[model samples]
Target: MPIEPQALRVLMHLVAHRGRLVGKEELLDAVWGNHFVSESAVSSQIKAIRRATGDTGQTQQVVRTVHGEGYRFVAPVQEEPDAGQPPRESSSADEDGLVSPADQDRPVVAVLPFVDLSPAARHAHVARGLTQDVIAALSKHRWLRVLTGAATARLAGHPDVVEHLREKLGVRYAVEGTIRLDGERLRVSASLTDTAAGVCLWGDHFDRTFQDLFDVLDELADMLVATVEPEVGYAERNRSSRLPRTDLGTWDLFHLGSYRFFQFTREGNGEAQRLLNRCREREPDFADAHAWWAYAVVLGMVYWDTEPTTDLLDDAIQATERALRSDDQNAVFHVLHGRVQLARREYQAALATNERAVDLNPTFATAYCGMGDSLCYEGRYSEAIAQFEHAVALGSHDPQLWAFRTYGALAFLFAHRFEEAVDWTTRAASIPNCQYWTTAHRVVALAQSGHVAQARTEVPDLLEQCPGFSVDYADHKLFYLKRTDQRELYLAGLRSAGVPE
Candidate 1:
């Protein structure tokens, strides 16, 4: 029953020229513009329009075909007031805005067309391009439902645009911004607002040169997408904390679980799993919820020494399978599935799956990290390091930054680059709320670099966090590594760090 964009356009055009025949060529120009699509495209759109409006070829009650000429709207139609007019006040348009009961379950966001603040109107295209780029980039994530910019374009100039978006479009978050041109230089200002809560969650300004517009657009888009996802997550987590337990929806619970999962502690992992379980219970078919729950279970197994029983492994596998079955195109789900493959020592399968994840979302940092992990296990250290670096660059400020850095250090160690391993692991350890496991890598790297004294000093903390750690445990952790020499070298470094035999 959903009207597609092209069909909606056709319907609107028909309504505008009601009672008059609109030529095929005119319809093409109005809808597709300069695009060279075949007449079948228009026919298909007309068919879709008929299906959506319950009009039939036999009846032709609404949209009448003109046989060889074009089409006409035979049905009477009414038009709303022009968008330029002041919006009429309704019960839904109170000071804040109305929130639909259904929309409360998920985060809805809309990216408004950027305002052009250039002295010359000729640079308006640049502003529009940036807005499109941001919307395209953000649309790659499956978690947030991103509304089309065109849907909110008219409301962008309203004094109460945020409230309007919230009430009319049911948008929980609104991203609005302006672009300014100063001759050859460009500046962009953007802000993200939690419309329901009436709070500005985050805002920033970006400056660039107008050398190559497309390149600049890509850069700005990447940066904004990277920033927006985490900022939204942070905002949602804060909002979830204030809500009563009974009021929390599946999405809210998942974000709350992720906030705990990223802490990388024993208690946090347990709590994350508990919340993820509840999330899955609430929405069994939610792919993202299933993926995160599987990820949390795997992390508990790897770090928290949770029993990796057959039932536990099956739970993780089934959750991932369910996620992939629901949305195979989702990059995060593929990455989580790849992680399960990696844990099961299916190196080749994991590598291919992670590669597919990257293919699905080239900008997904976690996919690259998963690929790096697989490559490192295959003893392709240099290639793994490259993948890790790409992941780190894309996710520099992401919640998984610590994991990227730690994996990068591991890749460096496998490549026999001890000094680089020490440096990256140190940075990972220095990050706020870094996982405890990073210190273990630092100890091994220091020992391998012949800094035995420094390595010895780090041993106590690592031992306290991972008691009963041994060379056998190190070997178990590196089970995916095909090369015995690489695994042995890693164990030797751990041994030199005074880990138990």
Candidate 2:
């Protein structure tokens, strides 16, 4: 009669991407880690989830199949009602299957790469450069998870794949634009697309004298960020997409690092580390690499312990500083730096960093997410919840899905909503992605909520795999639940559940 962990994980992901038909392939990729599983495994799990939810394939009623595409969640979710607390305000879902309108009441957006109409390889470089610049400007939002440069570039050239990109990445809106250069003259155009509606939300074009290249790019960044800023429900005056430093060749280092950064596995993360390290090595003056390298250490740290975490993170701070020095104008670097600052428990500074990042990169989802987290640390629980829920609306394929779930659960736990805390943490523990030491928190939440039997079962594996996992990453200054009082209680509960830790 109980729900299985695997099925529960699928259901959680479904809820995360609920209200829209998610492609089966996307589900496999996001939930099952794609490359390692069989379609039958997914099919089998779907059936199990249906059984848990009290649905049959004939009625396939709750999780409906969309013929050739994928499955969708039809039922509205109830948070199991946190004990002693009333349901919070709810917003209407967004027309874009990506962001529910309720989510918009928070704020987030994705900036796609710009297209290059010129065939010269140099023109391609220009398009990607323009995109990287825009990305930096928009990354200031701490609560946002805007697609990284590489992901946007991958989708940039293929406007035809926009739908596929939307479905797979799970973002509400995308900023698609183009750049064309005619001898001594420049033209740039940008359009905001509601991924689900296939309609342009806003469109604008900029023309500038070729001699004023930097000015032109800056103006374009300003215009684009401003245009998308209000749409995400943030004020235009708060926009601050400036990279902290400007001397570095952001295009080369950023893209190279981005291509390597997505490897996602322990080894992939290592390769990313190597590439970003190289970027730092070559561009010692480049601050962006530091920001990225800090992010890389965070990513590498997420899967397994590779570096002397303290040393790796310290280095991340160094990299972020260099990026800030190069061009302090981009919200990307600011949000990223805020993450590192947050890890250091520079709470006030981190919040300022995230706020600044959002101001620069109004459409940046990670900024919104970071804003929520910073607010949580500041005991702004409701605001933090709004930011987390908003970032979830923007969606992400980050190697850190479990972290997101864990962080969301932590917010609930600390806010003293035990039931909601238990639900989110339990969902996090069941993530099919790489495991982290953070699983201990889920056990802690379960035990605290008196779900001792469940606690007894998960802690042993949590210990064996991430026995020493502590939730401190210099990249995201979240001083996680470190006290062992609850961890010990969790161990006792797991023991009662017949788990040996």
Candidate 3:
């Protein structure tokens, strides 16, 4: 009786573990890669294996069933050498036992297979799917390089695998986690580790009801991906601070620049530009660096009133274009490109570019924010508000949360929904490190909504923060709005708020 290939593989696996019981789900994942299948499939394969090995369900010999649990190969087994084949050769390893090269310039991360801690070990497929989802999400960013699933699986059960991953796989960071299911509740816990230093950079725990398995997986993956990048950035910034400025690499400079950029202040923006310039000089081919550089220029022009000379605008355009040239698939590059288009008053082009960015990375909150801004400029206020709300839901704790709120407020204001505009802009202003522009929207919304006293009270602070702001500046800012009435409505609100002409 000849056994099927899957059955043969399952038999070999059982023989390797001989005395230990293996769960049916584990066998399914190992042989079928987690494709949905019935338990009957495993039963059929086990029956075939028993027949080929001359074992019976009644005999309790060779393969033995452990009641409701799984199976164990109880009979002794031995490896046989093929007469026609030579001995297998082992792969080369360095002195540290690492197989990959150690001179990687970018941060390399490995997402290890998630451990299943559920009762009866029944959720192995869910754990594996979560691991794969995280890998896929992280791979979309051009900055980080992710290890292959096979490489990560090889190191899964090894003792002291964190150090082994650093040495063998050349990974600077490792993401390890476990999933557990108790009744209908599911819990996921994850930690980001700096392999070189043997320190945990970050950790998080999430709990949700297992109402819809795929939905739960998607929400978990999105939250993890969103948290990981910022945590890595924070870790890298701390690491870079201890190193001499003269010795900083491109990656270090980028992280340091990002730390300053998130401060949302004029001085921070200036320092960010200087550090990113150094990064660009060191590695012109780094697409993420170029995209961020363009973003810095745009922020300076929009918030700081930095004079945007033709050369400066051209440089911003060139930076984003080079980033796209380097990696057209990167959604971040497209977001920056769309921002540049918005600055140029190319509303249609901006809208289309941002849509493509969202299509590339559905979980990218900034892309949706960009899309909202584009729609707002085109006088599509309702549609724009929806996009902004979606962005907020996706990344409520994002570093750019204030920006999303401010934009959402602006969309509502343009739609003549003054109360909502006031609510959102007030929320934006209340957030820590919010830029001064948030107050401008609040003043306009309050004044237009007949709260003249409150609006007037806010004027002194707004003027103190933005002395150069006036009706003319507002007009220039609203130039992107093609509809004359839409632009005039914004100007009238500013004038109502006591803005100087």
Estimated TM-score per prediction?
0.76, 0.46, 0.74
Error of 1 at 265 (Å): 1.3
Which model, 1 or 2, shows the larger TM-score? 1
| TM-score of candidate 3 to 2 decimals | 0.74
Q: Which residue pairs does candidate 3 place in steric collision?
A: 98-167, 98-168
lDDT scores for all predictions? 0.78, 0.61, 0.79
Q: Determine which window of 10 residues in candidate 3 has minimal summed lDDT.
A: 94-103
What is candidate 1's TM-score against the reference? Answer: 0.76
Ranking by TM-score: 1, 3, 2
Best by lDDT: 3
Tens-place lDDT per residue, model 3, 255-368, is 788878888888889898888887776555556667788889888888885666668878988889887875678788899999988887888898999999888887788899
lDDT of 2 by residue, 1-501 (tens): 577766766676677567567776566655554145666776788889888878998887679877777788888677553589542211221122232221221223567768776546357777777788777666554334455675555564574655765666556567888888877678888887767667777787877776777777776675566456545432211121222224323333344455555534666567667766775555344454567778877656545446435776687777787667655766778877887776665667888888887666554567777887677766677888887776654434333456666677667766767688777766666665534435655666676777877776775677676444332231222233233443344344344544432
What's the C-alpha lDDT at position 307 in model 3?
63
Q: Between candidates 2 and 3, which one is better according to TM-score? A: 3
Measured on C-alpha atoms, candidate 3 has an lDDT of 0.79
Off by over 4 Å in 1: 1-104, 309-311, 467-482
Better of 1 and 3 by lDDT: 3
Tens digits of per-residue lDDT for model 1 on 264-369? 8888899999998887665455566677888888888777767666677788888898878866877788999988877777778889999998887667788899
Higher lDDT: candidate 1 or 2?
A: 1
